[model samples]
Target: MAVQEHLIESQDRAAMIDPFVQLAFLNDAIDDLTAANLDLLDAEWFARYARSVDELTARLDAISIEARHRGHDRHCGFFSTKAWIKHHVQLTGSDAHGRIQTMRMFDLLPTWAAAARSGEVGVAQTRLMARVAANPRVHVGLLKCVESLLVDAIVLPYDEFERRIRDFQRSADQTGAETQARLNHAARDAMMRQKADGSWILWATFGSLQGAQVNEVLAHFIQAEWETDWAEARNRCGDDATLSDLQRSEPQRRADAAAAVFLAAASAPGDRRAPLPTLNIVIDDTTAEVIVSGGRLDAARYNKMICHTQNGDPIDCSEAAAIALWGHIRRVVRDASGVVIDMGRRSRLFTGAARQAVLLLSDRCLWPGCDRPNRNCEADHSLGWKAHGNTVPWNGGTMCRAHNRLKETGNFSARRQANGSWTIHDNDGEPIG
Candidate 1:
């Protein structure tokens, strides 16, 4: 009976190899599978296909490991299993390396290997487990325990699975996690390249902690910009027209917000590469220092000494006092009409206190979905000077160059509304879409 079972197993294995008996047969099989009626496949079919592929990948990895252990790579004139896999399978160096790492994980924990072969876990989830198991900081026994927990975690969503693994690792060894984090932080790098087409692309890798902080700042600006759509709705007195106002997608908002953060940081006084705006603290001569509206100190209580920038960002009173003591100060006085009565400087273009006043009122680029801080924007006339527009605060609005160009080319228009907010219009005279 045992001899008959061995013969059946051998025949089964031979039949599996029969279809891929040659390179042509394998290539034709792949082509045939690709040409199958994939559009008719349901979600269940997709899930099963994905799981089957993962299982096949595990079997391939096991075969590769066995071949390497048996010195087949040397016979094939390859220096390493990675090189062999890359040459034969057309995988990238990183993919080949990851395959070897997976094989190592399988060798260290047979249960994980079994689970991977059974399609109980996916390739990505298996990779995550492999990384955790291979952490030199984790003891062998602890990894065994982790490997077991991951068997249950295999059913979790990908993100949740990663989080659970991280939590487990952190709980098992806090010091090791910190050390790994430091290593990861040390590996961080950023590169910005301007393409020949005058477009810039940024590539960056950040440690988890810094990445979280960056995400928070981006989210804050994204949310702020998103909220402005509703603010416009309120300005329009809850008109149904605003249901589709300012059609920037969420991804675009996040991208613009990321750029705004970098611009904000570069505008700091300590950064001397460019002439950026300083924190303007408008104050009265009252020695008691009762706070008035405007500058960084707007809406502060008379008893308390909170200060603000012209753009209405709060600053520490000490920082405000230091700026007051030494920074360039140009007094800007506004009349009851809310027009700048005194700009303390004169130019064809709005500059100095006049520019600051416009920036303060505008708060951000007049362009919809642009959350660029006022300081980074240029002051522009909503109506062109050639069209009889003045350089006064009332005539001027804040805008980044891209939007200003649109207005210049007659593709965009901004009209001051009754409530002090500007109503942006497209070239067709429709509200900004």
Candidate 2:
């Protein structure tokens, strides 16, 4: 309650010098709580504690919105308030954005904000309501219905409440719901990135039509694999294996089938973006070892050669060997001084293989926090080619069309650092993270 009072006071003092100083007080309060005997608390005590914390969070959300309104975030040297919250509060980017968005919706719907403050509607449920309220096409009458339910009910399961809200949306405006579904479909994407420990993670989202097609293909492969597994199980167990015992877990089977689908698709000829699959590696000649992107190849890693991707995710030699099966290798020769002597280059603007190389190297748009894939980006000279910049590996990076225009308008400047990172400056000469 004292912390909630402090948060309310902070709003009136929005011009307070060094907003980060208030953050330090909040951190100290959190540390004090962490040092308390939370685990020893009983169930009822824990429930009450959680409720109080949720109320505190709601109040802080209001204060955060007020702070943003007064431009305190910018004065604190942050590019955006969301970025500031991510760094100072230690919340993930998505979580910070969600909090901001929820508060904005609360400002629009006062009744829901009051309910959240009173702990009638929970923090999670409030956020969900905020999301539903964000749909511009949803009639105000639907929100009024939700608000009345919140004010009258003691407690409603969040899932059921969400369903009721959706029912309202569908009944009130089926056309809008269909149009929103189409918009969501247009945002489908996939990402493959390696982790720090040499393993890879794949994340993907698909539209309804595309997802149905993929599911159909995966089902065919799954059935085939399932039958093979079943036969093997029966052979090994003779009389013991049951129908359930014959099959692998659904997730494992699906993973295997997906890999099969991809490998088969790769081998099959079709229209493609890049002519060949390629893996880029930096290696040191002296120790016959792989070199990391930034650090020189001379650095020792447990007295053995080490390798990693441009993003600094480690990989072993065997993995590189596996990739070579699908892709041809290109060599970069260096002189005795460890300077690259030849990289197979020609034109002023990177095209074909060269453009592909830049895309693969950058992985995404060079603009900070702009996750637009390199496939959607245009190759740009980090140093203007008109100013004598060469079309070489070290001089070229990928920029999405929007960011490229910002560069052309002199609002942003970018340069490749020796460590392979891009140094970007805003119009005011401030560095953006």
Candidate 3:
């Protein structure tokens, strides 16, 4: 009798507490947090605080989903849920649509939704997952492997996680991937328009393979300009040279490179046509075998297959195999550590095939968060030539010119690990990433 009476009393108290009151309490807590001194907080505290915020955001999203289902927007005299959100939250139309789409994704992915509500997953990761889930061809497969994908989302870096999702999409729906590739090729377009100021603006889009080819030629010309800038900066500023000392800004160099390309094309001999740029497509044995056999492999094997351009853009397996037939294919051998063990002969400096091998080993500059393409980077000696570092691919890593100069200053250091990844450190001996 006493237990029943206590339960009734608890139910009455719960019924008395309004949602607006709960929100008011939440606002008060946020005010306290905003007033707290951040200087006294540590990294762990900040991480925990971010997770708490994520949890709250997830809860709000859940409430929004319920409101949409209940036709709350109609009751509030709004045409749609998105319009209601846009008017109330001061968000743009696109942003409001994105919120609605995310709500739908959460509805489809209950496991992920629960994890989000618990603060175990982040907004960025959830957004990426939602994007993959939106793909009609791979949606079912994504749902089947949500548990494993969730683990990857938690553990891998954002860039790698994105790549992983792409791999999954390609492997799970090869036909869809190839069809999309063809559509992209069909949609290629370019236009140049002169502005009122007498300057011109060029806008263009190309399929992945064609874009890579165009970028390769541009990068070669840009590299020549980079060399000139380095020479001029050395002559003028000597040891204290910095990126600001360069003769041309990056955009200016790109424009110059474009002009050079046009002039070179106009001067071509005999046929009056420039030769096609060579593209380097890398494919692992597994992917090549699948292409040769004309049969799909299990998802696990397909996910592990490596097929991409040197610029790190994933290519459809069938498309890469077709390109391999006409292009010169060079074999690259790597050791168990994923280090390029053999490409060609070594020399005093990274040149010829050795230099090419270094570029092939990396898609971008070794510096964390630096997205400069490999062709625009210098092959740096990790241990320094004076320190007896060999001129082999194993001893070399790619770095942009500015970062190379920074490393030479001794204020920063970088080491290439056995896995062919770089570990960068600051002057204080703290790892940069």
Candidate 4:
């Protein structure tokens, strides 16, 4: 380890340009492809080159692993082994960790690895294939068959490949995993798809549903709300203060929480909806009207854009901005596009730089015991956001929904001191600094 570290330090000390540029160049070189030639090419060529690299790299990795496992001792057998790679490359703790993991996936599954290397499959399709097929050999077969149809499979985006892989798995018809290999390998796309605006058409469900099954249900729920008059839903709430108030107040305050995720198998447009995850911030129909008319309460100003004039007008602001300023919740937000690149914090006094730093510090969520990725992770103010807890990165940490809820519901408390490191406490009062 020490020798490897020294070798990396010497390499870093040597003059070099940008890491990003270097990575891009190296990625191009591996495929026997060059950017110089790409200047005159079409999109298809890019796909082909990517496919080539995927195939070449996968083959190299498999060979490298076979060599190492055959050559090395019991511990640290593969070059792509994350800890080994990170130690050898001297990567930042996070980049080193992530690359190591991704590479290991290629190493662990030979068939998918070969398919990836052959540029015969898209990453998303490959990932789904890996999950559904579950065996190295099967994945390899999938790659061979799937790649045969496309000019450059590597260039194909993940989303585009999802349905195709499913079709192949089902033999182009609706069926369960065709074989044990398919069952062992297939993984559902866990991410909810997004549009340029924060509003997502997500597939929502609870209780172990997968793919379009959940989304079809959500399409029904959203349709139900949009199609029916609000009178029934609201009246039910009004008749009982608790239930009525619950729907009106909580739902209004918590519209972002209500923004359901779509995980449907069929990407084709459909009509269905799912019951919303409730936050219990009920608003009376009159209150909804008042808030939309510019009631100065934080919820009014915040969700005015999320909520409406009781007449269902679109609240012209980004749902993120509306939720951030008024909802008293720090939302995990995607740029007007639907991926959570940054916590929607520009309006809350935190800059993008700070958000980046927090993400880096935590890598994912910092709930101590959780491993949610950055997309589900939020930038949490060590102190409460409204309690004059500055939105500066120094006062924040990347935390996922579960822990963020911990902070919000007061199950945990965070203290940021003069030096800016945070100390968090649990229900039993043990402190984690």
For candidate 4, lDDT tens digit of each residue in 110-173? 5556665554555445445445454343443444464342332354334324433433433322
By TM-score, the better pick of 2 and 3 is 3
TM-score between model 3 and native = 0.79
Give the candidates in order of TM-score, highest first. 3, 1, 2, 4
Give the runs in model 1 whose Cα sits over 4 Å from its true position: 1-69, 73-77, 171-175, 183-207, 229-246, 249-251, 262-433
Compared with the true structure, model 4 gives a TM-score of 0.27
lDDT of 3 at 327: 55
TM per candidate comes to 0.46, 0.37, 0.79, 0.27
Least accurate 10 contiguous residues by lDDT in model 3: 328-337
Residue lDDT tens for model 2, 1-433: 9999999899767766676897899989989987988899897788788877876776665555445433436766887767876787788988888867776677777777676665556666676766766666554554546555464233544443454455454434545644555665689998999999997777888753345345546666876787688788889887577767865887788788888988988898787554342334332243232321222222112222322232222233333333333344332322233323223335777787567656655556888768665545788888777777777666788898779988889767788777566878877877765
Better of 3 and 4 by lDDT: 3
Q: For candidate 1, report its TM-score.
A: 0.46
| Range of the 10 consecutive residues with the lowest summed lDDT in candidate 2 | 291-300
| Candidate number achieving the greatest TM-score relative to the actual structure | 3
- lDDT string for model 1 (241-317, tens) is 44456557667767787887888787777846533333345332431142222222211122222133444343333
Model 4 misplaced stretches (Cα beyond 4 Å) = 1-83, 86-146, 149-157, 170-214, 223-433
Error of 2 at 114 (Å): 1.3
lDDT of 3 by residue, 1-433 (tens): 9999999999999999898988899889889988988778698787677767776776665555445534536866887878887887788998777777777778888888787666576677777777777777777677777788788777666776777778887888888888888998899999999999999998889886777677778888988888888889999999688899997999998899988988987777877543653677777767676776887744554345677777677767777776676554333433234455454234567877677877877778888878888877888787777777787777788998878888888678888876456889888878775
Query: Which predicted model would earn the best lDDT?
Result: 3
Clashes of each: 6, 0, 0, 47
